[model samples]
Target: MIKDIPEDKRNTFAAIGLLTVCWASAEYALDFIIRCVHERYGGSQIREAPPVSFKGKPPYLREAFANHPDLAGYLPQLNEFLEEAWQIAEQRHWCIHGSIDLRADASTFPISKIIHGKEHRQDTREFTARQIELLAGRASALSVNLIFFGIQTVRLMPKEEANKLLRELLRKYSAALPEDGPF
Candidate 1:
């Protein structure tokens, strides 16, 4: 049955799957941080996450940290990570909103978004199979870093114990978490 499929379709589908997984990881990390902040601020009274959302996540995250008076002293390394993560801003935008052109052997994706009424045609990019795979790996790494860093730096949770609990939570929620995730 698999043999009947064309190579481009198979490859594109695989990349698409990876892209979704990577996207999910990033989204989960963002939501996780948001949830933690909300709960820490006494949102626990509602027993559900608030309806708030963020645009330009990095800035929002930084601002979120600032808003939490307690975390005002969050380590300089956390600030540094946020700065480095911003470097991927273009790639992440293109991977999600861009159109993918599937040819005989690979895919090229390009993205353009109007922000503040300005056309952003500057950051267009193309991706090969290897590049897409690398992006997936990088995205996963970014999320894991966010999870660990957010817990340690933002939540002020102890690294070893917090991560151990997080790993267990991830394992337990591995099946249901994605499905239950934000759309």
Candidate 2:
């Protein structure tokens, strides 16, 4: 029965399966982190498990964004970052799970040649690397936002003051540190 199916269709099915697994894993991590922060602040003294499943398109990523109301001002940037990350992850999923016919009509070009050529490859490794870097920055921003929320909810600091301190901490952490004498 499997032998009767077309190669392209088989590859497509494999890619879809891989993508589903990646999305599930990513969502689980996000859910765990959010639940930890929520529980720490709620002061219930009893821990609750993270959600078993996410609902809707890109559920896990959506839930991560949805739970952070305090970071509403940064939503535009966060959304842009997550969208790019998802695209990169999807591309990686395809590359890993789908067969690439190098011998097919679509000729394989070297990385250097593609960039130096008049019409470069539509998707270059460098472009993907940059996207990943941007995604990391956005992830850091999300982490900082979560810290702020935790502080506020736990009453460690007032909202206005916590925001101010958080910004200061972000600036300090983001800046390059000077090299002191080696230990």
Identify the leading candidate in terms of TM-score: 1
Compared with the true structure, what per-residue lDDT tens digits does model 1 show for residues 43-107? 34433544343345555556556666666676365577566455444555666666555444444
Q: What is the lDDT of candidate 1?
A: 0.60
CA deviation > 4 Å runs, candidate 1? 1-5, 41-54, 67-69, 84-89, 104-124, 154-183
Local error of candidate 2 at residue 75 (angstroms)? 2.3
TM-scores, all candidates, are 0.61, 0.33
lDDT of every predicted structure (CA atoms)? 0.60, 0.43
TM-score of 2: 0.33
Q: lDDT of candidate 2?
A: 0.43
| Candidate with maximal lDDT | 1
Candidate 1's displacement at residue 17, Å, is 2.1
lDDT of 1 at 102: 45
